[model samples]
Target: MSKKGDFEAVRKDIAELMHQPEYDDGSAGPVLVRLAWHSAGTFDAETDTGGSNGAGMRYEAEGGDPANAGLQHARVFLEPVKDKHSWITYADLWTLAGVVAIKEMGGPTIAWKGGRTDYVDDSKLPPRGRLPDGAKGADHLRWIFYRMGFNDQEIVALSGAHNLGRCHSDRSGFEGAWVNNPTQFSNQYFRLLLSLQWRKKTLKSGIEQFVNFDEDSETELMMLPTDIALTQDKSFRKYVELYARDKERFFEDFSRVFAKLVELGIQRDADGNITNTDNEKGGYHA
Candidate 1:
């Protein structure tokens, strides 16, 4: 077990676990990224309800949501790490794993601080349908992200995470990856979004998405309706175009915006300790 408060050891363990040869794309990084995003993305700024603090996904109410399908692989990947370091909260471990995975996958260095608790406050839990729908467009994107206090630029920057993972047909009812090299993080997603002529395709599952076949790679790349919506919207498109052209700028913006994302609804003291946390014992298993 790591010494108390030894987050560095936790970070190292997460790094070691990234080499999942049997997993999707031969790495657990992408799913770990998704797990962290889903864990924190439920935040509602107005209600001050959902965020990464509770680690509520361990329960059926949140975990059973259709939108969170396939994230179990991520949680399971981290379980051994959790067992190794029993002191770390699931909330903190999930978020930190994402930060570490991004860096391990050659992405920007995201700033993250740990103090989240495993305490599940029922009244504070976010209701179902809080996650953005991949089948939706610009208006739906705005409605979902705006509630989480993200602006159009931040929304575009966050969408860049798609460069990592592919959608599973059985899980999300969507198929294919956004970029050829899904494991490495880069501006390729934005670049492909601007450069490719994506044709609408309906899967056998009766799901709709946009696709572009790469002649060189002989592989089909895809974009969710929400991803296509970025280019279609004028405000969102500008950031996408900028990110496509300037990799450094995207890295900087993504680092800041993603840091803000994981920190949503978390109140902190001057010393950076999380203040608004339930310290009482008795919470769901994570």
Candidate 2:
């Protein structure tokens, strides 16, 4: 009846629609997470702007980021929800879907707020070099995420996102899924990391490649140099060990850190309603 009631009703409708078979497929969930990843990955602390908080990628420049290749699928997936609930912006919808995807897939609950606004103008798209390159090692990983204000623990926590999605040959120029069961959420990534003996592949491009030492099977699942570096590097390996030992810790840490990553540039009101504000340089509530 009232505007508030209408918004609540719409929210419920959107939530229910999220359960539809089309959206339930594992592909959509991982893709949605990737969308949120590309959007928020653009944060630049020095410039004091760019992140999931603004949902700026709806514009051309940001949408066109090479790291965001194949994201149109996610945008199309959310089109109906956006049309029905015009009050919710694309920025908010994309990040919220990421949270929902994580929860639905047996992952931890991601804390979410909804203040992101959509901008059609491509000028708002952040410059490139925001998303981390899968080809890089520890130094590059540190440099990239740290630029966005993430610490080593947070970096390891967020890398757990590889838990959800795979690297597409067309998308990242790397071809292989990380886990055997890409759709299912588990600490298997960590398990495999610890248990498997890895050997550098004979085929070497500037990019890194390593095959599992178990029988040299030709399955498509592959780990990036940085992903393997987690196990090799002592400091990063500690957190990975903690995650492997306690799945709960991985889920908890991931939920908190991911919430922070996506909420990087929005503000909220006293009631926790994300307000319409231009401020885009704050952290999300843990």
Candidate 3:
């Protein structure tokens, strides 16, 4: 474990990294969140095979996964931090970057605990297709997220993160920001979902998605089919409405779920070595 002041230094390093002139949109904050999500989202309670701790994404098997297309940008973005803070594990650095991004982007300050260790090689990569599919429905969302041990409310809370970024054409084959102020965190995503009149269109990228329709102008904000599912499904819609109505509530829930996520599938042995987490429901989160 790091001494008391170490995490504060890590946070400082991350704040510096967030504002690179060469990075997309001048903020790596959004993609860092995606990187952390993809890293932890692979956990399966039954197998205890994957999560953020391994940093297996450094290896080809996980790095090359199609769902992780642009994450290399986020990963490589942290090289300088790794160089400076050699004592911190890659897993801890990556997830803490996500926490720092949320706060610096004018979102919540997520609670985080550190001490993850990196895996040595590719042997620990989770099987492909464990991450959520963007174009799927609520059922697919449940199946994917449930494997990571999230309940529906937690899923909806985490989904509010879409409020911070856009889908890139090169990465997800989908395009446009989720809100006008994509770099700023807010409840706008849910508000837009409820307020906008979205129209389906097949883009030149050969992807199908919903775009806000305005006969007078171009629509820059979008919602994936999975995003749309929250509204269309009665059960998930409740939390969506709750978040859309109260940004503070959304922030609170988001922080809770995220703190849990960054630490998912993490357990330490008696000698204080990181190990595969106990797979029991709510085990790691506790």
Candidate 4:
């Protein structure tokens, strides 16, 4: 168990990292969020096979996975915190950094708990392909998220995270930000999904995606095929409208579901131990 005061130290550390002149706009904030999500996103509800406890993402076996492209920057950025607080596990540091990033970047406060322990090796890394692929549509979204124990409403809420950060060409082979203020989290993603007219375009990399078709739309933002699916699918579209019309509701749901997500496979086991076994697997991708 960690001392409560360490959380405050982490919060402060993350704040300092948010605006480093040497870094991305001095804001590693968005990528940190991605790190946390990818770390927790590996949970397999049925097999109880993977989750955020091990912070296995540090190993080449897991770090090298393409799903985690460009995320290495976040891990590298988080190292200073590790140096200062050697007692904290990388699992806890990564997740807690995300909590700080969300609040620092004008998003809702994420409820966080930290008791994860690191693993010894990569033997337990989750099998690859667990994370969502941006090129796929609603069906793929459902398949990927359902495996993680998220329902359609939760799926829609999670997808809204697209509002932050842009797809990197060297990373996901996709390009562009989902919203104008990529560093700030808001209902802008839902709003644009509701209002924008999107047109499909294939990038020079041979990737197919959508961009705002209107001349007046600021940012000329782009969307993944999966992003558009939120509106194209009736059930998902309803939530998109709800979130667009109500920012409070979006923030509330996002905070709750996101809390639920990072804690997956961590609650308890038959022996009263938390789910992080030595053959532990964990951490975020991209």
Best-performing candidate as measured by lDDT: 1
Clashes of 2: 0
Pairs with steric clashes in candidate 4 = 38-284, 38-285, 39-283, 39-284
RMSD after CA superposition, every candidate: 2.1, 4.4, 4.5, 3.9
- Candidate 3 RMSD computed on C-alpha atoms after optimal superposition onto the true structure: 4.5
Clash number by candidate, in order: 0, 0, 0, 4
Better of 2 and 4 by TM-score: 4
Q: Give Cα-based local distance difference scores for all models.
A: 0.93, 0.72, 0.83, 0.83
lDDT for model 4 comes to 0.83
Model 4 misplaced stretches (Cα beyond 4 Å): 1-5, 120-124, 213-218, 269-286
Candidate 2 per-residue lDDT over residues 57-76, each given as its tens digit: 76667778788888988788
Per-candidate TM-score against the hidden true structure: 0.98, 0.84, 0.90, 0.90
Question: How accurate locally is residue 274 in candidate 2, as Cα lDDT from 0 to 100?
Answer: 56
- lDDT accuracy of residue 98 in candidate 4: 84
lDDT of 3 by residue, 1-286 (tens): 3343387887898998888767666789999999999889888878767888768788888889999999999988898888887767778889999999989999988988776666533444589999988899999999998988899999999998998878889998999887777778888889999989888879997799988854444656788999999999898999999998998899999999998888777776775444553233111221
Off by over 4 Å in 3: 1-5, 120-124, 213-219, 268-286
Q: For model 3, state the Cα shift of residue 271 in Å.
A: 12
lDDT of 1 by residue, 97-206 (tens): 99999999999999998888888888899999999999999999999999999999999999999999899998999999999999999999999999999999999888
Q: How close is candidate 2 to the true structure, as a TM-score?
A: 0.84
Model 1 compared with the native: what TM-score?
A: 0.98
